[model samples]
Target: MNNEITDSGVATGLAKILADVAGRLAAAPLSARDPLHVPAVATADARVRGMVLRGVDTTRWTLRFHTDSRAPKARIIETQSAVGVLFYDREARVQIRCQGTGAVVRDGAEVDAAWEAATAFARRCYLGLAPGAVTGRPSSGLPDWVEGVRPTEEQLLPARRNFAILSVTVDEIDWFTLAHTGHRRAVFRRDDGWRGEWIAP
Candidate 1:
């Protein structure tokens, strides 16, 4: 009997598991970068008190998200740059957790590039009055400044003042999968490389 688990077998198994988890995450329509994209995001607002944002796997694993400058979450990032993002897919029975430190980037070529990529509707997210302001029941739609009409280039300039981009540099990722017969877990940490271990289901 071949007691040794071939590296190919291990790789294949991990690939299949990752693909299944990715499918589940895609089906859930959760933003890989924004935990708020998940339905349960609001429920944990009090405890977590921040948005679950993901980063792109680029040179620095740049994690970008838009928020109003006045939102409390911005302050949270300022005080505490370290944060975690959690992703769970019920159908696939998988969870992905990412940890990293965040920073706000404003007024630069990068900011301009990100802003250019945003759609007009997304830009509208920043047009409202100071974020987190309490408001009574609206008798009508949002104000003209924010919704009554499209913003011009000049208007967008000031709007950029309120827009903020958050970048997260990933330090580690923990991936887990649950199955009827068994469970799988892997932790990938920067600088330390990768480690895999199996646990009882």
Candidate 2:
């Protein structure tokens, strides 16, 4: 936490920070090698989980991820849309705190469009018996047919029962950078066409 500070310099600094993180996200397919891959997502209940970086829509200032329809995350989003998304670029010592509202799109146009755009590799996760299922075994609980490979599009059509899109509409962003000399922190809000301020770190 820090004191109130606002200036053009703060705005520019914030943009550069955001752009840096956005650039890392743009290099997606989200591999372990990527600077930013798994982001921490928090629900209204304070449940925090890590999810892959699905896609970043700068045009709409939204972030997308796919999850099981029956998962708690989906129901949480349905009731309380407020969510917190965190992205960290360890090498750069930068962390982004995204404050947004999330919506679970199941069979709607948005989900249909996103499902179509999802690569076979990405869509493979949903082709399972159930998400977060408990079995006596220590595995994903997916059957052999849909395991270890991308199911054919025909095989995947039925997987829609579990597939859902998590769309987060970002409204506020807090960015921080750590340096040897000191630290910098800034916040940007969408209200009134984007306003930002710098605060002591």
TM-score of each: 0.70, 0.83
Q: Write the per-residue lDDT of candidate 2 for residues 1-201, one digit (tens) a residue.
A: 121225656655666656665566666535767766788999999999998777888767788888888898898889999999988888889888899999888888878887888888677777765766777788776778777877889988877778888889888888889998998887877754556778787
Q: How accurate is candidate 1 locally (lDDT)?
A: 0.57
The reply for model 1, stretches above 4 Å from the true place, is: 1-55, 139-142, 192-201
Model 1, residue 168: displacement in angstroms?
1.4
> By TM-score, how accurate is candidate 1?
0.70
Candidate closest to the true structure, highest lDDT:
2
The weakest ten consecutive residues by lDDT in model 2 span 1-10
lDDT of 1 by residue, 141-174 (tens): 3356556677776666667788777766656656
Model 2 clash pairs are none
